[model samples]
Target: MRLVSLLVVLLLSPLGRAAEQTYDVIVYGSTSGGVAAAVQASRMGKSTVLIEPGRHLGGLSSGGLGATDIGNKA
Candidate 1:
């Protein structure tokens, strides 16, 4: 759920271009989805960079959250 929410926010986020270097994909956050995106791109042979403006990473996963209930559909 968090990944999906982050992805939607990322898709709606603004686009940026870097002048110093080049990358096939530039993820602008340190959220789990952002890291996943950068990793998958690298695995697929694309140059990638993750620019985390904040001081943290891993999104809610870094906060020690637990799993949801068995019937969670949201």
Candidate 2:
């Protein structure tokens, strides 16, 4: 859900300033998905740039909420 929202925002963002620079792919937010997108673009021989507004990456998981279901499932 979060990824979808991010994508929408990026898609709607203004392109005037962006038009000055050229890139095969521009991934907003440094979330895991963003990283993957940039990586995939690079693998395809395209110039890719990953932009992160925050000072860190990995989204909430890297923001100290990496806890998982380690308890018994039963």
Candidate 3:
């Protein structure tokens, strides 16, 4: 079983990773939800790869848009 798991990781690692890069989860957007989800997944003990084509994190939070128009906040 250990060997099988190792083999699986070896085989899938390349396809799952970028050139010389590896990540269990590749998040393309830096949205609030995406960051939260990635954090949650990491807490679950899984390798994660977060990638945001955009040049910033926190979708709107880092974008200087605080005080959401919504009626609730987490």
Candidate 4:
């Protein structure tokens, strides 16, 4: 009985192992913040993946803004 059960379990088990992608961090979006985060993660020696909805990066800056110029601090 034990042998039969063991054999059944073994046979019922998945024959192929699922391939898993491991990453320390996953950044969704290639915007400035996303790029910065990914770069920081890479600098820290952690794996990172940056995904962008658009074809370009740098978000608004890449959209012909040239420079962000978020004002200056007093």
Candidate 5:
């Protein structure tokens, strides 16, 4: 009985299942750096995915801070 149970458990285990997805690069956020990383990965011919936790992208840039200057203008 113990052997049979072990065999059944092994048969039902997910050890041999292949992953549903494979990405060369995965960006965890939709912020400027995350977007840039994803873009760079794609530009280098790599598969990439950009995941955002919120309903929008660009973080502060898209959060009503449109007039903020990010770089020095001197």
Candidate 6:
């Protein structure tokens, strides 16, 4: 287990480096909020980095959610 963890760390180190290369905002989540945040940040002239544990882009969106679960739509 330790070796596997170390291998994972080593493999993901590059990604970490890339994320730190230069960014005004680093959003960590694959949810809709995360993508929206990134876009808004970029539009504001801020380099944005969207980091998510999952490989897919949007969490529930790409996972098969026809509609978002924002109970309280402001």
Steric clashes per prediction = 0, 0, 1, 0, 0, 0
Worst 10 residues of 5 by lDDT: 63-72
Q: What is the per-residue lDDT of model 5 for residues 1-74, given as tens digits with 9 covering 90 to 100?
A: 99999888877889735569989999998988889999999999999999999999998878878676657496
For model 6, where is the 10-residue window of minimal lDDT? 14-23
What is the C-alpha lDDT profile of model 4 across 1-74, one tens digit per residue? 99999888877788634668999999998888989999999999999889888889988868877654557555
Candidate 6's TM-score: 0.58
| Candidate closest to the true structure, highest lDDT | 5
Ranked by TM-score, the better of candidates 1 and 4 is 4
Taking all chains together, each candidate's TM-score versus the true structure is 0.56, 0.60, 0.54, 0.58, 0.60, 0.58
Tell me the whole-model lDDT of each prediction, alpha carbons only.
0.81, 0.84, 0.82, 0.85, 0.88, 0.85
Query: What does the lDDT come to for candidate 2?
Result: 0.84
Model 6 C-alpha lDDT versus the unseen true structure: 0.85
| Alpha carbon RMSD to native, model 4 | 10.9
Candidate 1 lDDT (Cα, 0 to 1): 0.81
In candidate 6, the residue pairs with backbone N, CA or C atoms under 3 Å apart (3 or more residues apart, or in different chains) clash, namely none
Which residues of candidate 3, in runs, are more than 4 Å off?
A: 1-18, 66-74
Clash pairs for candidate 5: none
**What residue runs in model 1 are displaced by over 4 Å at the alpha carbon?**
1-19, 64-74
lDDT of 4: 0.85
Query: Model 3: clashing residue pairs?
Result: 25-49
